[model samples]
Target: MPETPPITKPRRRDLTLLGLAVLLAIGLVVVLVVRQGGSDPEASSSPASAMSAPSAAEASATAPIGPLGDLARRQADDPMALGSPTAPVVLIEFADFRCPFCAQFGRDTKPVLIDRYVNKGVLRIEWRDMPIFGPESMSAARAARAAAAQGRFWEFVTAVYDKAPARGRATLTTEALRGFAATAGVPDLARFDVDAASVDFDDAINADLQEAQSLGIPSTPAFSLNGEPVLGAQPTDVFTAMIDNLAAGGPANS
Candidate 1:
């Protein structure tokens, strides 16, 4: 078993944010008890250090709103999003295709979340590409965006994660990605391949990377729930509790 490290707050850089950057930073106090596993593949299955989670009172006292809350795009037709646009909660995830912890969350925890909250119109989930695992992961993100254009983004994402190894990068070569795209039912593989190889998704993917950097996110599988920063792939109960608290009209800092 990989050793759990000491609890550390999210890194706060002495920098200014403007416009879209502000959407990912202001009021998003980095108070997450995340694992180090996602940042280092060798520690892939290491459990989260939830023993360091803040007390309920401490958590409530700092519940943020305002700019933090506005992080939810709620766009009516975002291809990479799940659930109703107006859902009470929005879960924004920053992840890399080659990160094991990210794949674990996708394979294990996310489905439960989808069943419990997303399906009920109580929550929405948006994906952000943080391809920090290098070239193959970048390729996967690009392919994912291309898949999105065919209205198969989520399917493509799930398929890639499902096929990925639990301890290393998935083979995301042009041929492999196209195969995955075909499996995901992307109607036009010819166009999908072209788009993936093009620079069409660079700006959007770079925006997500910059967003994560602005937040000082140091790992994959980082998340924001209606602006509440959650650092790792915690248990399903952890997510449900947060959603339940918000769903019941709990207090928040405006």
Candidate 2:
């Protein structure tokens, strides 16, 4: 038999045709399989998973409502209400009394804010003593609580902060704090002094300090407006925006 002729090379056109046929078959199979199932990725997701995904509104609503949100909503709504019981927002101020920023807030920005918003009954400002500035701070906080018992808390606080030394010193010697109480028109100075030294007052300040530590408040002049915690002496606009947002019945931004 004659030697078998060398196998002829497959025609380029035939190879190309074969490759196209294979690709077409694969594409058809893919199309058929996709059609058998739901073609949309969104449609393919299980209902439970779909439900777990947050909507934009839901995502935006996760702002820090603070540890006291429910309590604040129920008991203290006014953000700046000094004595008003009907205010709609409450501002929980955590202060060390000896922090310069606290002094600045109390002396400058606070007055303006108080006169403009607090006095108008849009907010209720409630002070909580952190006393991180040491013994003097604890003393001042105790005295402040004593004043509160006599309904002169705001006055005593205002006087102490207003006259705070430039170097962030707020001496709270028994006599000095008493002097502040007197200037703030606190009657029964002797009674105030006794109350300040009482175990009750010390316990109250200690409790506030413990709570502040638990809440991770690292500095003075921190605040929670409507139970949304805000750190540092943020600008007036921050407070205004929160008040405005809450008033609008919208959750605050994180």
Candidate 3:
């Protein structure tokens, strides 16, 4: 018999089609993975996942009024505060004395707020010490509290911020603090010094710091204007608008 022809293997064209189909399948899988991971790969794996959700800074410039109402500790005798306890709106500030942004707010926006809203009895401002800048920050906070004990809190803070450098500097020394206290007119320097170094003052400062942390305030100069979270040292207009909106019984961001 004639030699039997060997069985023919698949044609190259057929092999090429199979390979193309496999490649197409892989491409589809890659597309699916990318879609699942989101467009920004870095954002998809951001460290915020480890924290308790997005902070006020990460949220809108002015958050809507909601659960943050609890942040208002409206003590009638809170000396480090301004305006009336019965004011229509309350603004809670979580700030660090050593934070330049906080100082900026103190120097620029705070005065406006005080003039337009605070003095008008339309708004109240509660101060919370969030000393995130180490020992000096804590010391400054304590000193301010000590000043508050003598009813000079606002004055002391204003003086300190007035003398604060354009950029952040380590200027809050014991002697410097005493000088600021003097400028604020704290009548009893000896008492102020003693109270500033007391455990009670430390605890008070810690309480404010813990409250800020719990509310997801990661930095200084964070504010809650009538329960609407406003982060950073925003423009004076931004604050006035929010205050005006709240005063009119409108929404926080309106």
Candidate 4:
């Protein structure tokens, strides 16, 4: 019979130290998230009709309206401000950061859309948040607002979803949330913290929810190309076709 292998006590100690290091790293990440403020705990929905009618400021930036243009511009927040002002075709995405489907769409199809259209100045994408996933979801929404406060809304939005755990939940646990803000390239974490704790972003998030409700957007990853709604996590081809059609100045299909 082969001799029994000797027990390695020193190896066990080394392994224990390695485990401690990893745990410390995780704890640090959690700390960063909290300090930076990723989400809020006070978000809730409001009546869609409660959203004030458009003001003159909104009207001035809207696209040309006759029939089709009127329908398209109605849902658009800005006519000259698609994803980037230069893009002609506008893509409105009503999303929830905590929604697994929305994250998947962001990870899978959005990059392609950006690369093929946004980068090419053909498609302008606007992201609207519908924070319906509980308290933590509110935090996530607030974090985005904080980022936008520093002119990094899209960057922060992308980072939050990207850093979310495999379960796709934003815990808003202070540390976890701050980690996201740091990654989003926000320069003023302190101010962001104060903003996160305030009611500044409440109206914005509520307004977005109202907008979605106005458009009958009951679920997430709901997309629109020039006012035609597309429900569910659709394939890239579907988006491509809609975008192409919009770019051609064709009437949108409901």
* Highest lDDT against the true fold, candidate: 3
Backbone clash numbers for all candidates listed? 0, 14, 0, 15
Query: Please, what are the lDDT tens digits per residue for candidate 3 over residues 72-148?
Result: 55566989889876677788999888888888999999988888888987778999999888899998999999999
Candidate achieving the largest TM-score = 3
Q: Of 1 and 2, which scores higher on lDDT?
A: 1
For each candidate, C-alpha RMSD in Å? 18.9, 13.8, 11.9, 23.5
- List, residue by residue over 1-254, the lDDT tens digit for candidate 2: 79966545676677888999999999999999988675446645778545543331232243334455522322233222262444456677888767877887777767766776667865556667788878888878878877777778878878888888877466778888989999888888889988888777676677777877877777787887766788887777777788667645566552
- The residue-by-residue lDDT of candidate 4 on 1-254, one tens digit each, is 99988759998899999999999999999999886563322222434423433331243233322221222333344422235544556677888878877877877898899888888867777767788888878887887777777877777767766765666565666676677778878899998888777778799789888988887778887877665778888988888877776666665431
Order of the predicted models by lDDT, top scorer first = 3, 1, 2, 4
Clashing pairs in 1: none
Q: Rate the local accuracy (lDDT) of all candidates.
A: 0.78, 0.70, 0.82, 0.69
**Cα error, candidate 4, residue 170 (Å):** 4.0
Off by over 4 Å in 4: 1-82, 165-168, 252-254
**Candidate 2 vs 3: which has more TM-score:** 3
